[model samples]
Target: MTGSASRPRAVLIAGPTASGKSALALSLAERAGGVVINADSMQVYADLRVLTARPTVEEEARAPHRLYGHVDGAADYSVAHWLEDARRVLAEAGGEGRLPILIGGTGLYFKALTQGLSPMPAIPPEVRERVRALDLDAPALHARLASVDPETAARLRPSDTQRLMRALEVFEATGRPLARWQAERTEPPVLPAEEAVRIFLATDRTALRTRIATRFHVMMEEGAMEEARALLARNLPADRTVLKAHGMPWFARHLAGGITLDEAIEGAILDTRHYAKRQDTWFRHQLKGWSAMTVEEAAGLLATMA
Candidate 1:
């Protein structure tokens, strides 16, 4: 039998932010006896619910929700961590005869679920700290990485500090290129795509941009500043994933009196728009065979899946 045939079928709902994927997932979960699980990386952190646009308590109460706010903001929550949690959740849902609805805009998470992920060795704290202590600019780090692991360095943009640092850390930890480890991957995919109904919410570019702007505005009005303030006060380590959240830098500046609230909002909206655009592009190219539809259409299709 194929991989999917041995497991209960799951539904994967993916889309750019503000595309109404969460609402659609909730409606479908309520109707289809499915549990709505978070696939978005940001939503896993408890620190930025409003800014991350995580499902509200009322929405979550409407359906079974899993993995939302299960992680602390200061934690180094990696894809491996998420994949492990997700596999457990999937098994639990299967055991209960409940459909599993995985929904999020994080393309990497969905990809890992369907297409298996290569194992990355854990970088030692000393090596990680050494890299972080350099505080090198992206270009300088990229140059440094190029000297040690040119193949990985070539693949990353000079401005991609996180990825550059990751590559450098891997090299420092293992004396091997990150690409080499990736090529050695043998782990099996957790969710076979053929066994799941994949839905991609496609919105018009203009509409998505407008929605992005509106959502940020709402976030500001809905205690997003307070959330940012609280998180900043915790003084978490720099490499924590929560600090890389969209609007974080701008919010920090606003909190520090380095920028006006209006400027921070504008910056956050622009960043979100760029991120949404990247998400749209990624789903279009990386996710094959998914049924791309509007949110309304997706809600209608859920009954068929159920």
Candidate 2:
């Protein structure tokens, strides 16, 4: 693996939703001649622009943006896919002599970029279908995983249906626990920590809660409902990642006459605030060696780079 000193410099901005990460990244990118890359998983889908709070058209017009709204909603995009796309974009940015500024709240994407990822075996379509069709709730799935792969099951939360399902599928396909495969990871980090300026934007909890609620309201007024309608019109599978974008389920309920628009808006707002809390917690615990600062402080630090 190449040393960090041999790698080109990049910037990484991460934080909870409504934390102004996009604005900071755009401001720095425009002044520094940097390419803004999407690190948030949901923002990559073309179908959830408003709900995901992806950069607006005007924002994209102001600077070079990569990987935003570039994936089909029906596809099951994963961190592996994101890392590959990021590698390509980072290379492109380097070749063009532009700084690469990756921004998002997805901690796993940043982790994979700096710490590499495990190489899991390919899961056949039949195995995936079998695992997904087991007619079990998350806790039940976790129990089932315990029977086959106790180590992995113990590590995953009983409430995490997606990860439980993935663990089950891995065990079924390879006759080994997912943890075993993860232990064999040999991929090198694409951008080592020493080669980049990493910052996690911190906001007071009360202020962040207010911001999240306000942002959801703005999203709805700006056509989040219509965006949800279009995405639902596609009839993607329930398990598709895009279907679970924040506010989507609530909007779906509202559109289906199961709830009023006001109820939908409130539900979306509440859920988003909860998600933001989770994002903040995850970054604090999982992302190490990252500078934590308010937006203004980060901007000041980044201005020097420009």
Query: In terms of TM-score, which candidate is strongest?
Result: 2
Q: How many clashing pairs per prediction, in order? A: 0, 0
**lDDT (CA) for every model shown?**
0.83, 0.84
Worst 10 residues of 1 by lDDT: 1-10
TM-score (C-alpha) between model 2 and the true structure? 0.82
How far residue 12's Cα lies from its native spot in candidate 1, in Å, is: 0.3
Candidate 2 all-Cα RMSD: 6.3
Residue-wise C-alpha lDDT for candidate 2, range 242-266, written one tens digit per residue: 8777788888898899999999888
Best by the lDDT measure: 2
Give the range where candidate 2 is weakest over 10 consecutive residues by summed lDDT.
1-10
For model 1 the TM-score comes to: 0.82
Over 218-285, each residue of candidate 1 has an lDDT whose tens digit, in order, gives 88889898899999999998666687677887999998999998999999899888878878887888
Residue 97 Cα positional deviation in candidate 2, in Å, after optimal superposition: 0.3
Clashing residue pairs found in predicted model 2 = none
